[model samples]
Target: MAEKGDFKHEHMADEANDNDTVDFSNNISARIKNPLAGIRQDVLLRDVEEFAAMYDLSDITPLLKKGALVAQNPADFENVEGLDDTERDVLRDEVVHKWRQPRALYTTVILCSVGAAVQGWDQTGSNGANLSFPVAFGIGDTDPTSPNYTRDLWLVGLINAAPYIASAFIGCWLSDPLNNYFGRRGTIFFSAIFCLLSVIGSACTQNWWELFICRLLLGIGMGSKASTVPIYAAENVPALIRGGLVMSWQMWTAFGIFLGTCANLAVYNTGAISWRLQLGSAFIPAVPLVIGIYFCPESPRWLMKKGRYSQAYKSLLRLRNHPIQAARDLYYVHAQLLIEHKIIGQTNYAQRILELFTIPRVRRATLASFTVMIAQQMCGINIIAFYSSSVFQQAGATVLHSLLASFGFGLVNFVFAFPAVWTIDTFGRRALLLFTFPNMAWTLLAAGLCFLIPKDSSAHLACVALFIYMFAAFYSPGEGPVPFTYSAEVFPLSHREVGMAWAVATCLFWASVLSITWPRMVAAMTPTGAFGFYCALNLIAFTMIFFWVPETKQRTLEELDYVFAVPTGKHMKYHMTKSAPFFFKRYIAMNKNATLEPLYRFDNVQSDAVRSASVTAYNQEHRKSETTKKLNL
Candidate 1:
């Protein structure tokens, strides 16, 4: 009714108002939006009432209301009415002192740690047995002149690769169903049984094929347990300390490797039965895992997914310090789940697996998960983890000295992993990967080049061991802790089990390839060539990570949905254009005043309608600018 330009300007101003509500521009600092942020008080109360009624929680409805309010705005817990001093103090501790968690939570972490140790022990068991078993089975091929050398090398590699073959092809794939039916604790217990029986069977096998079969059986346990334990730990811990707590999987796994080396050294002199004991001693870690898993509470998110809200509330009680904290987490997670269900929709197991590639949000997480998991293998840690003894022997050490050096490598691996507990959440996951990969690459190359030194020279073995130890030192704090922790936390809960299975399978598959080919590779390429090959791979892994992996420190599992929702192209462009230049200016050019703008805006308390309107307004403003420029031209 007004002049045409005036009407147009009025419409644009409305759109601009909408844009202001949900600024999706690159200038905004990224944050995880609170799921319950913008709901009306009455609406939230009604939802809580319905939730309590459905879950038989009306007995605690008043508590539930208080919990819901706190969950909606955790920062204002001090202002939450009806909260006592003790409850307020506990909430304060969660922020001011995050490490002061319930003892039950630590106990659960310990159990998962034992499960990880079993995995590490299984690997080194085969490692130590490698020196003796091939000869015992009539396939020793150390000499190049032997007519059966090639065949024996291939066979030895196959035996060494047996568990990973089974893991990659069979075990990892079974996690979803096992988790769906048996629950986390039950799945771990089942895997522990398999690990225990297989280690004992491996020790008793009379021939190569028998031992191979036992190790293959062991893979089933390794794959499933590896897939489940990190997820178990991630789900149980608070988001603030999730990385440090979950990384205990890698930390204790290193401990297990050290313990396995000790066992290998202890039984080195046992007449004719040394390899047998080395293989069987791995069962020790499995025993505790089999028994202790039941003592840990099942994951509350998983329980919530199954619609066992009452049970989830109970489980949360064990993990958190106070009843209010448990209720708040349970309610918040439930609210997030409601949004997740609306976004992801219901799908069958196969559909969920397909969604790993099909859904845009989920597929980003899949790519990121794959990047980190495969990077773990590409960084070449397992080559040393699986064959340090053989590598040391090749460096001209006597058998005992080789074993001792492998023990030293194990010690360095375990000792250096401690720093990641503090750094992973602070320096962050992506930063750790970027920093360590280059260091690992150079150190690994140096270790391999040391092989060129004259074997008669005393410095040859020392030089190789020194570089290898340095590589482990770099590896332990970064790639060692990040892969499992990142993979476990990245996916939405709807697809968590299958997503973790996919990630673990990718890791074990490549691990199998490395194990099966290294003996042949080392024989053909020499130590220098093989190490150099993986050294180049470390650089390639670093590049892939720089572009593909997103930083995911201190983000809750539910909140990660928004993080991954950023398209891969946008994420890649931001790093390539923005992050890369910032790094160059700040570090290379030594710029004192360089400031890198954040790529994503945080809409923590914004409603969907507000965000949508904000986008509309931003687009309208962009169009108006373009029109103005066109007119001027």
Candidate 2:
């Protein structure tokens, strides 16, 4: 089994011509179009001996001459200097090409999405509950002029936020152990069962305390499912589809919220008991999740981690279209496992947590994930998701009108979710974050500004609602889904489940802090003030994304390990543009030995529409290649 870069038979004379490296610019798009798509591992790993001697110029020039590899970017050169350029290229490209998409892959992603939907539905129902349940329980008055007008700020805040303590902390903490023992599917299965009981209990609550207990239980399931599903989808799908599929978890969560909003609208005027039915409908989605999850294929990476090699192979075969493709994927899974096993050794939870911070690449990944999760919750979208009905009511809508507006919020969330899945792989995760966060900040500020206009004016309220809708439009593509998809690809299988739990726990922390204290935030500062705070948070998120996050659109999970591991330098960020002289000047300053050519594959022209348009070209090329080899020739 020679490494795939072995050009012993195919290109020896070409390799011997040191200056004959062909122009790769034309094919760079082909490579960029599917950086993480799989090619055969056997084709990638055939030149073991030559690649092993990569430090010797004699060993390196051959592969470079063969046009099978290129030099690392100026930033990456220091770290990867020992490896020949061609070996790295094949290593990345093959991993992408080796995977053949399978039908079961989609089935598994959809099943996991049920858990996401369950979480969304639960959140939206509670948002609606805040509309009518406060009055029903005799805790607060919707009308300030009523006889029973006291807000009961303590009880109201407790009722609203008690769920977070359970869901964010306890539920998220529980996910790591559950995911470790039962795997992602089993964990989501148990979460669905718990949610079934919790949803019923919530609807039947007689007091604020009873409702709080029920919601706390609901949080347990919501938190677990939220933490587990994205990574499960990431592991099962090929990279070409990974962003779209993993993002669908968020989309389905939006779907669940849509169902919840529609339920609320149905029951808004049906008397005191209508809230109960609104809450109870959440149980229905859980029923399918509990039953369907067990039938879907488990993550092959997880199977391999547990030493069930045969089962891992079977699972991969079901997920991939070709046998050799399945085997090749397993080889990388095994290779990464072996590499980590020897270096990482045996570790306890404490050690793993410590390593999560200490390991340079993994730590950067964790920080990036944790930062995005925190930013996402704090970006002010949740304010709308959890309380749009109230925001509408406060803005001048009647109770029914507010409920209808909330339904629109959910509808927008659900409708825009489709675009994220369609474009996430091409648009690139970092680009979306960079582009959308500023727009979200401005839209929220505009909505807040609209509040300062004269009271009882329908025009002012309409402006505020319009701003909220626009805010949601910006949020759906980037902040809504990219965080989960980005978090899923950063960790190796060894730490993936627990690593994801940690990222989700960051959500728990922010969601808890934000959800628990939202009322106080609005009361202490005016609503306008609160919105201003979130606007600042979005700007902070934009700053972090600009400097820290790398483009991870088309790269494989393993290939991303290399992307994040690139040497960190403060000066490296500004020169990332397309100017060749700027990059060459910087390259010379750092390393004179490496060649002076532009190192990165993508350019500024990679807009969402442009990136998405190229996928058809790749597919057409692939179809043409297959036809060329067939008897139709």
Candidate 3:
């Protein structure tokens, strides 16, 4: 795809806009490709204001004088440009095969996904402990007649959400600086070591506050990996399978939830998992991740950002099929870096952090990323997962049945989440969110209403469990993985790490906020009000995604940068605040007067025209061979 599209644009540049040979800095040959060559002049004039509003005024000079794309290996470029139909098919197959290698995409997915599992362990393990811990630790005043017995709503909420609080404040922001200094592997290592300590502390605590303090420690480590893992995994794989690989982060999360529940099941009557063993079981995944993360390779793209071109090439070489293929992928990285050098000179950490909010497109990207993550937390899935056993007991099940039903729910969560691994890239992130949010809202409301029935009615209990499972079914693919996947891919490589870290911070903060409040909300108004609140959140999520989020399917990570297209910092506020966005248009042209018709033809406005149709088409085409077909396209 890179060869087919970039070559055509390069050919069009040479044929239509002949430029005089000019020497440029950084050994780049200067040539302004009139990317608008074949468009109608009237249409260009019609959308003149749109073009100017879309990009910054300050970027016009550099856009016009933009240097030509450079190749790391020129001969490999020739091979792609000269390929016949059969040769193209063979090459595509080879690319697919190489990407599927255990060491390449699969290994990256497994190691980074432990981040998700760590989250699941804390949540589900705690949920299982909730079954008996209140009584065991004298949490909520089992005997009103006894001395020192009081219902502490505020204390319970605080203890329940302690981990999320620590995660939001510490782990979330910590990833960016840790990533900057120690790189992705070091940050992940930091996360694992801390996660292990939190688990040990949680297991040994005798009182609720002790457990709360332990959870706080857990949040610190968990937050560290929350933002770092998905983008790290995404960076290592080809864009072809990027969604599937990144979604693995959530897949392992579901597995961890299941593991936590199973541990609960094993010790349910044995008197272990209630407070100690269930929390300690997080060590199962954390131990392996800590030992193995150091063995994983550093991101080639991160390497390029540091001016370590040789190491970047070597990393890509080990990941890709051949040195030529690695060089071709690395070429795009270098080309993007070279262009940025002309516009944004060496930026310190402080400057990059400032750019996250002040830069129009970066700000836009931040909002887009932040909104989905907030939606993910507020979507009510995790609430259902952490509170399912409690809800089961509320629905009139015995203690044993509630535990059994909770285990079943955990298994269902693990089973249902796999569909996303195949569908996310094909259906697109926004499409999935749009489809699932409505389903989640109604199901949650209906489940809450189920409580209106008699406690002894089997039908009511069954309906509640069914609603919870169906909600998970929708949520597993919807808000669950999409936030992590979408946030990882949207931001430019320049501030991608910082941007994603901020998104994760938003999630952690909200996760804590919601977790703390759910208990009090239920205690005050019953499950009905909590469910009603979740439904409202889902509706808002639908609206935000329908408008703000763009479909990022079938595009390379570098190509995705074009989606935002906001220029430099000088005129960013005007572009961001004052204008209606042209987000769907391809950002191939940067010239002041360039027409965008060639880049985004009339039929190609994805965010607007084809958004709904994508869900239907993607559903019909979801088979084992779907990946190969999409890549072959």
- Which candidate has the highest TM-score of all? 1
The alpha-carbon deviation from the true structure for residue 277 of candidate 2, after best TM-score superposition, in angstroms, is 1.7
Candidate 2's displacement at residue 333, Å, is 1.8
Root-mean-square deviation of every model? 11.6, 10.4, 11.4
- Alpha-carbon deviation at 307 in model 2, angstroms: 1.3
Model 2 weakest lDDT span, ten residues long: 69-78
Candidate 3, residues 1-633: lDDT per residue as tens digits?
121012112332232223312121111221221223333434323333222232222233122111111121211322333334443333344433424454655776687797678788667777877777666677666344655443554566577688788877888788878987888888999998988888888888888888888888888888888878888888887766788788898899988888888887787776644668877778788888988887788988777666565566668767765543464465445444443443345566778878888765577678789889999887887676676777788788887788788888788888988988878877878778888999999988888888887877779888888888888888887777789888998887777778887888898788778777776677667887788888898999887776677667655675455455533231233334432243323233333543322122121121221233343335545763687788899
For 1-633, candidate 2 gives per-residue lDDT tens digits of 222112122222222223222122122221222121122323333432243233132332333322221111211221333344444333343333423356688788887787777777867887888877887888875455655543554466666666566766778767777877898788988888888899899888898889889888888887788778888889888766689889988898889989999999887778888778877888888888898897898888777666665566678779876443454465444433443454345566667777788776677778778878888987988888877877787778888888888888898888987888767877778778877999999999999888898766768778888889899988998889998888888876666766787888788667767776776577667778888999998999887776667667766675555455554442143335433354455564664554443334442111222233344346657898998889566
**Lowest summed lDDT over 10 consecutive residues: which window, candidate 1?**
1-10
By TM-score, the better pick of 1 and 2 is 1
lDDT of 1 at 382: 91
List, in order, the clash count of every candidate structure.
4, 19, 0
Model 2 lDDT, residue 328, Cα:
48
Clashing pairs in 1: 15-617, 18-613, 18-614, 19-614
Residues 576-604 of candidate 1: C-alpha lDDT, one tens digit per residue: 99999999999999998999998655544
- If scored against the real structure, what TM-score would every candidate get? 0.91, 0.77, 0.77
